[model samples]
Target: MRAVGIAVFLGLLAGAWSQVASPVLRPDCDALEVEEAALVAQDYMNSQLTHGYKYALNQIDEVKTIPRPDGGENYVVEMDLLETKCHVLDPTPVANCTVRPRQETKVEADCDVVLSKVGGVLSVVAYKCKSEPESAEDVCLGCPQLVPLNDTSALQLVDASLGRFNRVLDNDTARFALLEVDRLATKPLAGTPQYLAEYAIIETNCTNDDDDNCVPLASPVARKGFCVAAGTPAFTAAVDCALFTNEVAPVDPTLNGTGPVAPPVVPKLQTTHGLKHHHRLSSVNVPAATGLLSESEESQEVVPVVKRQAPMDTLLELPVVPAVPLPPAAAPVLQLCPGRKRHF
Candidate 1:
């Protein structure tokens, strides 16, 4: 009877030990480690974008953990984000930047990030994001705030801003031309309706005065930028721009001497993770240097010229560093780790 009792006790102890040692497949989202992994994933995802406003965490839709055989864990975080006023190259920290006002068109992104942890260290494995722009109907209680892309008055404002930008630079080497109209909105300020615009520009083959017909230069080198402009149709209040160039030139399709040359469609701006894009243009002389734009007298902000060292694909594989804590108020998403740090 004593030997039988000992065997039963030993079996119970082994079962308890196995329960404690087994990996957790569905850890609580509020767990400190899970929160840390989400923060790290957000930081890495934002670092991949070289242009546009930084995305602030709006909500954590879901968080899950998968246990690996090697004692490592994979964290999958799904989050919603809203655009902030902070530019990617701006020196100002994202925590200090304010979310874009409701009067403007709302641009939001949904991101799915996967991170792996081993030996108490975290690394981003993969991430993808989808961005959308919504009209600001709630601002005026069902009144549309988003201006039509083909609005004549809005187009005039954008053109005026571009003309002013060219005149300000007065660069004899290269002239910038409008590439696409990203957004246009109308909002009341000081009891007056004002126009706001977000657009893109490229160094073109034509001179600054040749605005009637202009196309991007077909050289190995190219300069592209995103700009924000605001003001009345008669005058532009402000124009802030950030320019970038690709480190490696895209392949020229005409060199093959096979297929007919195809017309260029406005390439979708890869503000976040996306497939590589190629642009084709007629051959033209590209300036050795893309002259910088001076500080906008009206905006009081200096234009930034950033160069992308590698293609979009290479940026995804970049090594992520320790994250900087974002302000709790900015990202009211997960209340995970109350007294601990959070980032977006």
Candidate 2:
């Protein structure tokens, strides 16, 4: 009976393991679909290089699909291409140097074309591309293939790497402006996954003019050992100097320096009343009567007060002459005169 119980326990363990170890299905896209996606990527590449430079298709290296949680696929297409740019010298009447000189550069580009099924048809949803520098160090290059896992985790790793790269170089304005992802790779490590990335830092605005141009500087840097699906995503990564240590060579002091390595200064609006001043006023003990008074109250209190007085009379001596003007009263005699009879 003990042996039978042991066998049953082993069988149960196997069943649980099988459930946890189920294989993920590969993406539903086929070879024809991959070729179509590559064409789309090629068109995208051409559109980006439309500005004076030209690009020629070299070859489509590989096409692979990464499964999405929402039943979609991300077709990662890798390709190599050559770019040509012309540096035309100004024509002069004396030298007649009108002949334009052209330069060619070779680069590898990886395009991620995302597709999703809609109304029973697979349609393109989103796409992005990263161009590889020609002379970047090999240590900065990511693995050629990505691990067969969820693309969400891989993308999260890429995002974390990008955030760190931006934060680290943000101080140096010239270095920050030109930093871009050159390559990205992923591989399975133990039970988890790791990502490797390369970044190209080029001083694109460099020119001979010291007043307006930045000093020319360029380098390739590598950031590796980014573990995805880790407990702490942001802190679990490392960056190394693939081309230069700590930082690139400092710009020439005589050249138009980028001032200082600091974060962009946002002009703060000046305010008459600031929070510190408000707090300071609140902390002081002000008399209740003086609360409404302003700073000019002291000057108003120093003015002299005017005294009011009664008016003086100028006609005081004229009243004594009125008493003598009333003379003594005289007696009058009454005469008895006869009146004539009235005629009828």
Candidate 3:
């Protein structure tokens, strides 16, 4: 059945509900729906603290079948949320390598990602990366040659709000595990502190490269392009693009940009004798004994001017990801559209 009735649709929403699920419909929901949706949406994020992933999100779509406690029967719905994970790095070159210490930051979010309605509840299908296809000659190719080292979703903290969730599975590789989220929360997620609290609980299960089981860094560790306070939302903000911990650079992009050390404990160090022999010293190497420094004040200055992202600007940036009602007999599969603001 359609989420809202035709008569109530107009009064309840700013525009018609899309017939398909897409990234565009992320923000187009009705106000009431948006608020309630935001709550559930946040839970799907799970707290980013323990896992080291900057964002953790799984939408209704990932709910292959919902085993609701209230009774009747399992509900089928699609849910999903987009999470942005950014970290900081020195971006300097040292001899044959470049390294940026890892820092982790996570956020709760509800932006332009599909959240379909099932029995009056809004949700989304989980995110899954398609493996790279093999050329005509290679029939044995199995997975993507490269996977993102950093993972993301709209509401990481909210997902943590749930008791214990394996939002991302395959505990081995950087594979994305899209799981159901609404099933974990005990309350309706919507503009409430309780909702935020629980979501943080879930985010802890998220990981950068599949292993959400790794140990967490101290106050500051980073990856990709971000960092966090070691706690929940109080630790980081999506809008604060400039605030970041040192992140290590990827060695071989072909190897999927992951290094042996998930988060390096000690970064660069300065040796007393190293400075004098600048020529003999590797280009950007910091002597391990001295321990400290990167990105000169002159170089760091560029971050505020260029890398400082517009936090508020991104909030309203994109239109909601549409979720149009399925055609009577047409296939139920959904599609995504970027700027067109709609999808099939």
Candidate 4:
């Protein structure tokens, strides 16, 4: 009897192992439920991006499923994505946005997403992605690559680059302050790493004095521009920038009869390079860097210029008849309507 019981137990153990090792049927990539799970992962991935264009689903490459003992299934999904024209913060939904053309600054990515479905509800477990510029298939070993905006070393490089820019600028009328960092990257090569950055700057109210705390002006007279800076290990930086005057006048915080409010200020960051903060405003007129604009910034619309009429007191009354009459054929017509005096 003891031998028979032991045999039954061993047989039951083998049966359980067989059930656990059973092959899981892969889910159809085109299936509705599978598509939904993949989309959930895609949306989650897009939400995590803080800069540049949003990625749109290109194709669902594969989907694998594993059944759980508690009636839940785990989905492993792989998908391809292309950069879309719509920015990440744009009001347009990702489903409605169109992908960027290949000739443009297109970027592509391959993403792997894991999800779980339990009790008729699906939730994303985690996802990972690898993205690269479409044209950078053979990127140089020490070339710039896309990196997060908050990268510590990259930001430090940018700060140092800005110091260099200000030190070299020859103007004294205005100093440019950092407005935003559009994109940043670092090349971790052998000797010394390099940094590449694209950013925007605005003319600030502060002077060239190193001790002066300055704020960027928001008025139309205020100048704004975009800049690209590259840094090398030799402590040298190359910067190219363009400046443009804004069309909109400065906003008044007290216009609505409320008390004057202080504008948000960006805290100045210290850098290893003890370079002074002084940048000359360039006189060149150029368009704002549309490519550098994030989802929050839109191109400014041209405001119609309205002609102002001179005060009635300043109007000079002239005789209806011309002071000197010339030949009718060569005479210029001067017709002045009442209350509308023509000023020459």
lDDT of 2 by residue, 1-344 (tens): 44544444445445444433332222223345554665554443343331222333444544444444565644444444333221111011212212111111134333333344433344444443444334424323333332222344444554565445445633343322223333344545655556654333334342222344443443323211111122123443665422223333334343578553432122111111221111000111124313221232121221112222212232232223232222333344332221111110
Per-residue CA lDDT of model 1 for 146-247, tens digit only, reads 666777787899999988887785446567888667567777777777888877777888776566576787544667777889998998999877676543
**lDDT top scorer:** 1
* lDDT score for residue 88 of model 1: 51
Worst 10 residues of 3 by lDDT: 274-283
lDDT of each: 0.58, 0.34, 0.26, 0.56
Candidate 2, after superposition: displacement of residue 317 in Å? Answer: 99
RMSD of each: 19.5, 45.5, 27.4, 33.1
Off by over 4 Å in 3: 1-41, 48-76, 85-344
Candidate with the larger TM-score of 2 and 4: 4
How does each model score on TM-score? Answer: 0.53, 0.23, 0.19, 0.41
- Report the number of the highest-TM-score candidate: 1
TM-score of 1: 0.53
Point out where model 4 deviates above 4 Å: 1-22, 136-344
TM-score of 4: 0.41
Tens-place lDDT digits, model 4, residues 1-344: 44544444445445445444533445567667777887776665655553444677777766666675688887766666777755444446688888855543356666656577898767665555556555556455455665666767767767777666666762556778887676666766566777777676778886666544878887556777667777763464687766754643224444764444442221111111111211111111113312111122122212112224334432323223333332233233332211111110
Better of 3 and 4 by TM-score: 4
When summed lDDT is taken over every stretch of 10 residues in candidate 1, the lowest stretch is 277-286
Q: After superposition, how far is residue 187 of candidate 1 from its true place, in Å?
A: 2.3
Candidate 2, residue 268: the lDDT equals: 18
